[model samples]
Target: MNKQAPQNSVRLPERMRHLAVDSRGYPVIATINRSPEKVDFGSISERRKLALGTFDWCAVCGMPFADELRWQMVFEEGALPAALSGEAPVHEVCALYAAQVCPFLFSPRSRLSDEGRKGEVRESVVRFVGFESTSAVIPHASELQPGIHTLAFEQRGHADEFSYSSPDELGERFADALAREKPLPVSDAEAVLVRLFNRLDDEGEGDVVTGAALAAGAVFAKDIFKVQGLGAFQGKSYPTAAALLLKGTEEQILKFSHDSQDEAFSAIGPWVLERAGRFPLALQRWRTRGNSMVKNLGPSSPQGPGRSVAKNAPCPCGSKRKARRCHPAGVQATP
Candidate 1:
């Protein structure tokens, strides 16, 4: 008998990056970005693409990850060796910025950029923050390209983040792992969170959402989008929040707070064709459009839009004879 695939299909690859491994090679460090389309860490040369190395600058702040600092990862089950390279390594502050305002950060199953597949009701996402283990080392690579691409590392003891109850606690322990590392001050972290929250609020400016609700969402996105994929909006959780943020569904949330994100996706239809999903359908629709270029260029126009037969035809205005016979020569004779 042949072996079967697991009960739940892996919709997204488990991208385990070793960007945080130290120079001495003790622990391995890594993190996962939610959607593959959102994964743009590898656009530069290997030297500039510091996220691929064991030590690199923070993607957001452009500072080093520091000696023995703990970082966060959101992941699911996959072979450890096959863990793919992930997004650019970011500062905890920057990651904190992203965690807020991102609906998909909270819900691992949520598709951040792909609105067509926002909450498809599959794929379990687990979140954790941890430090590199002491066993991490540089892995052999045949061709080292830049930014963030998947590579293999031989690090052990990183999965310990799972044992902890909260990522914050793990971060503290990660601080302990650093040589002479002072744990990131809680006040600093709190300050970062507050700054990120203000930014989210600023982003929601002209939307239909209420001011109070929007502010609440800023906190919720900061606190919750990283953990659960949803924060409260119109009495709903992950799905509603995702719909509002990604699909611009403020009205939809008020109309159907009880429905799931999958239902909303199905209902949104052609509005999403160009934005996400079924590109063939969008192309086919374009090809078969009622008033197309061919229709516009010819004289047999059902609607008055395109360029119809011009200067040479007999005037439809009923002077009857062809343009050359009737009036102006070589001018685009009126039909």
Candidate 2:
């Protein structure tokens, strides 16, 4: 599925990544990025190349790219380990694994060439350096404008000002409004998730969701996607929060529970593709995977939001009978 960019900016020459697992329980084929030009739904190709392996980094332990067998296996096709695939993006299964298995994955480097380290720091440390380009993005959890959202941030000095909405207009303003400064060096993004969760939990006003759990949920969701042949839905569609919750199993849902905390999320990634049902792109993939990638992830798995749950055998309502058998009266044959 292919979606158009924001109305303000022209579509960037982006790549499409289709992440999935093969037969073995390893994080292979992180994703397959299709050409942005491919827009048609039914005409899109089913087979494409893959990007495999977790992008793990560690200060003490180096990457294990030395083993030829591992290198070969990295590109190989297979299923992600059950633990890794619990509830994250299908493509990020390898990235989460890299955080655990590889010492050099996604970790900050203390020592480096000035330019190299600076570049790395810039990415990890995002200062709210004002708006680069204001365009509305589909509100993730907030109930607001659906059109282009502003892409404003704090100055270079503070990286913590990255907000989903325009912070300037909000009543709560930053200390030095529009200040420019370097952002703090962050080791792992999991901390961001932790902070988000903590803040939500602290509000104590509503359903509190932790940052770590969210990140882990995203990670785990992706894993489930890989196993379920739903990798094509990752970024192609814009799904709503409710729609995003449709993919995964009872165990995966438990993994992202509020109480799971940092420990459970230590090996998880963000489940950005949860909204596959909210948009047209993801919806198309949901329909295609049932026939194309069913062998790898299984059609029974909950891979999309709008998917007919009743068609999935063994109804969630606890009928103790296949959905089709118990509700054959409602099942409609596809012409």
Candidate 3:
């Protein structure tokens, strides 16, 4: 491992700042090994790979994933059948930083140090596929060695391909991609807004709120807050303003979920009253329901073990049912 302090040339993402640095001054990802004597960036740790499923940790920062959507980099020929990926899930920022700094990703001609690894030396493309959930973990079919596991996503989201000659150029491309996101259809946006508001009304100013509604509301409020000053939905009615907010929110959710679901959930009332210009009664209902909802959801926890494990595959917990029906009902297996 590199004893020298990390180079300041690359501004790593906040989550990656605490990672172990290699001799090249690059922060080693959680899936890579960093011992006292050496930092092996070429190989992934099997123990950590398993932990990805067991603990629902990000592959890059090794932290538990929260409300943010899961992301994974896919090379030209690296995608597996049924939307499964050998690479573990990571945060969007982590994936973007890795693409900017990793030689194999940013430099098209750069080859992996280990030629024996899967998809070695092929033309590289920084393609990030997003997902709503980490669906499953099964033995890696592509790995010659045993005990290697692969992760699967339940539902894939929008994907973008980035091409650039330099890291700065790549950053520009990322920004451009976000800017190019098409607005959600007006009808769809109105429906989402009306539905959420109606749910809040139906629940009344009481202390209880549904989990699904709370989750959706948090996502809605957060996205609306983000696009607030972007010069959208100005001088509109409460329903129209909220619908426009939903439109912007849907666009954002299509890209990635909120970073803090709790914060977003809490902000619903403030956003409605201040931004959407809603009445006091609406704000009161939001506060009452949002507060109760947060208490019920508790603090954010690991999103897995997912409920999409293959019925014919061995349980992730090392069980061997005859028909491999250990996860028949998609219940979490003990890790």
- Strongest candidate by lDDT: 3
Better of 1 and 2 by lDDT: 1
For model 1 the TM-score comes to 0.26
| Per-model TM-score on C-alpha atoms | 0.26, 0.18, 0.44
Candidate ranking under lDDT, highest first, comes to: 3, 1, 2
**C-alpha local distance difference test of each model:** 0.30, 0.24, 0.44
lDDT of 3 at 295: 29
TM-score of 2: 0.18
Error of 2 at 280 (Å): 18
RMSD of 2: 21.9
Task: Sort all candidates by TM-score, best to worst.
Answer: 3, 1, 2
Off by over 4 Å in 1: 1-48, 51-54, 70-72, 77-84, 88-94, 107-109, 112-125, 133-156, 159-335
Model 1 accuracy (lDDT, Cα): 0.30
lDDT per residue as tens, model 1, 239-325: 334334233334443333334333222222222222233222212232233123222221222211123325567644457666545
Cα lDDT of candidate 3 equals: 0.44
